[model samples]
Target: MHYKQLSQQIFKKSSYLCVGLDSALDKIPSHLLKEKDPIFEFNKQIIDATIDFAVAYKPNIAFYEALGPSGWETLQKTIDYLPKDVFTIADAKRGDIGNTSQMYAKAFFESLNFDSVTVAPYMGSDSVKPFLTFEEKWVILLALTSNEGAQDFQFEELQNGKPLYEKVIEQSQNWGSHENMMYVIGATRNEQFAHIRQLIPKHFLLVPGVGAQGGSLKEISEIGLNKDGGLLVNSSRGIIYASSEKDFAKAAAQEARVLQEEMKVYLDQL
Candidate 1:
């Protein structure tokens, strides 16, 4: 999906919510295990329940990769089952040399047909630029993340006193336009949103670490929103694993609705 279409969806749905399918096998309800592909079944139900309120769906690749070949098949099926109008993200933070990155792009954009993929920019321009070559496929580069360990490098001040993540955002703008590139700014890093927004005023941000991770939706929404509603706040375990029983889908829908309602309030202010 292009930026304009995504923006329109946010307006049409009154939401900037991206439901994260970080569906782990061990955590899903045991009843689903009876199905030949429990993961896909779980995802299908979640999508069905939340699709009306959510504008995007992100499937974190690690959860499926751990399940091996069958996991991949399940992932493919889940992608195929998703509504085309809702954006899809392969939350595979892939980054490699130019040649390998191209293959990763092809796999997600051409084969699986994801609208975007999370990418690491630690390898610099060549690693990230390859993913930007595809039309309408986004490269969500990691910036200030929510993980505790982000303090190790992302916060480190350079000789010029700029934080590492700011440098990442500043330098990367040249690689791809806001239309095709986004930054992954974790919701836990809400305090940084003001400064981060100034750095890339129009680019979309794929935010995670809300809900279960304890990031405040109000704080992030207050500081992070742009005129276009440039945010895709994601909730994973908090929504998908809301219940481990038969009420799982309903519980997920409830959680998503809560977020979407909050998002609508923010959108209305715009």
Candidate 2:
């Protein structure tokens, strides 16, 4: 989807919620184990329940890769089942040499048909540029992440006096316009949003760490939002696995609705 269409959907729905389909085999309800394809079954129900309350869905690639071939099949089936109107993301933090990166881009952007893929920029420009070739697709490069270990590298100050993550956003902005590129700015790093906003005010931010990770929705929306509602706050375990019983999908829907409702209030104030 294009940035204009994405931003319009955000305001149309009065939401910027991005539900994470990080489905774990061991974590899914036991009843689903009896199904031929348990992972896909679980994901289908979750998608059905929460589709209206969210504008995007991010499926963390690790969850599928862990299951081997069956897991991969389930992942593709889940991707096919998603509504086209809602943005889809393959949360694969992939980046390598230019040629290798091209293959990764083709796999996610062409084969699986994801609207975007998460990318790591440690390898520099050549590694990141391949993914930008696709029109209407996005490369959500990692910036300030929510994980504790992120502090080890991302916050390290350079001789120039700026944190490494800040330099990433600044340099990457030149590679692709805000229309085709974005950054992964964790909701847990809410304190830095003021500075982050100054660096890339118009670019979209794919924000994780909001629900189960303990990041505050109000805190992020307050500081991170631009005039276009440039944020897609993701909730994975908190929404998808809200219950482990037969009513899991219903519970998931309720959790999503609560978030979407809170987003509505935020949009109202905008």
Candidate 3:
């Protein structure tokens, strides 16, 4: 989807919520295991329940990849089953040499048909450029992440006294504009949003540290929002696995609605 269309969807839906479908098989209700394709079955019901409240759905590829070939099949089915208007993300965090990155881009954007894919920018511009070559598709380059390990490298001070994450955002803006590229700014890094906005005011940010990770929705919205509602706050365990019982989907919907309502207030304020 084009950036304008995505912005319209966020406003029209009164939400900037991205439901993370990190459907860990081991954590799903045991009753689902008896189904033909357990992972997809779980995802389908969750999508059905929460589609209205979410503008995007992100399935972490690692969860599906761990299941091997069957996992890949489940991932395909899950993508196919999602509502057409909602943005789809392949949280694959892929980055490699230019030639290999092109193949990876083809696999996710062309073959799987995801609207966007998470990318690791540690490999620099060449590694990230191939993904941007596709029309309208997005490259959500990892910037300041929520993980504790992010402190090791992303926070390291560089030549100009700016941390590495700040440098990543500054340099990446030259490769692609806000229209086709976004940065992954974890919600846990809420304090950094003000500075980040100064560095790249127009680009979208795919934030993924709310709810289960303890990132405050109110804090993120207060500091991170831009003129175009440039934030996609993702919640995984808090929504999808809200309840592991037979009514899991219903529970997921309830949780999503609550976030959407909160986002509605934030949008209105903007």
Candidate 4:
């Protein structure tokens, strides 16, 4: 989807929520195991329940890749099941040499038809620029993440005295504009939102680590929202795994609604 369309969904649904489908066979409800495709079954229900409150659905590619061929089929089915208007993301974190990155882009944007894909910019401009060639498709570059090892390098001061992530975001703006590019700013890194926004105010941010990872939604929403509603706060386990029984879908809806309502209050203030 285009940025304008995504922005319209944010207001239409009163949400900037992005539901993550990190569905794993081992973790899903046992009852779903009896189904023909357990992982997709789990994801379908999650999408159905949270569709009212979410503008995007992100399926972490690793979970599906681990399942091998069948896993890939399941991922295709999940993508096909999503509503046409909602933004679809392949959380693939893929970035390689120019040619390889082109393949990755084709796989997600052409084959699977995802609207966006998460990318690691460590490979530099050549690795990322290929993904930007696709019209209206997005490359959500990894900037300041919330992982435990983020401090090991993201905070490393560069020659210019800016942290590595700051440098990454600053330099990357040249490769693509806010229209086709976005940064992944984890919700746990709320302290840096103000500074990061200064670096790229109009660009969208795909933020994870909100609920289960203990990131404060209030702090993220307060500091991260732009005039176009440039934030997609994702919650994976907290919502999808809300229950392990037959009530899983219903429980997921309740969790998503709570976050959507909170987001509405913040968007209202905007």
Query: Top lDDT: which candidate number?
Result: 4
Instruction: Report the lDDT of model 2 for residue 172.
Output: 91
User: Model 3, stretches more than 4 Å misplaced?
Assistant: none
**Model 3 C-alpha lDDT per residue in residues 36-120, reported as the tens digit of each score:** 9988989999999998999999999999999999999999989888877889999999999999999999999998999999999
- Pairs of residues clashing in candidate 2: none
Give a tens-digit lDDT track for model 2, residues 76-130. Answer: 9999999888989999999999999999999999989999999999999999999
CA lDDT scores, all candidates in order: 0.93, 0.93, 0.93, 0.94
Off by over 4 Å in 4: none
Tens digit per residue, CA lDDT, model 4, 7-92: 99999999999999999999999999999999988999999999999999999999999999999999999999999999999999
RMSD of 1: 0.7
Angstrom error at residue 36, model 1: 0.8
TM-score for each predicted model, relative to the true structure:
0.99, 0.98, 0.98, 0.99
Model 1: per-residue Cα lDDT over 118-223, one tens digit each: 9998999999999999988999999999899999999999999999999999999899999999999988897788899888889999898887777898888888
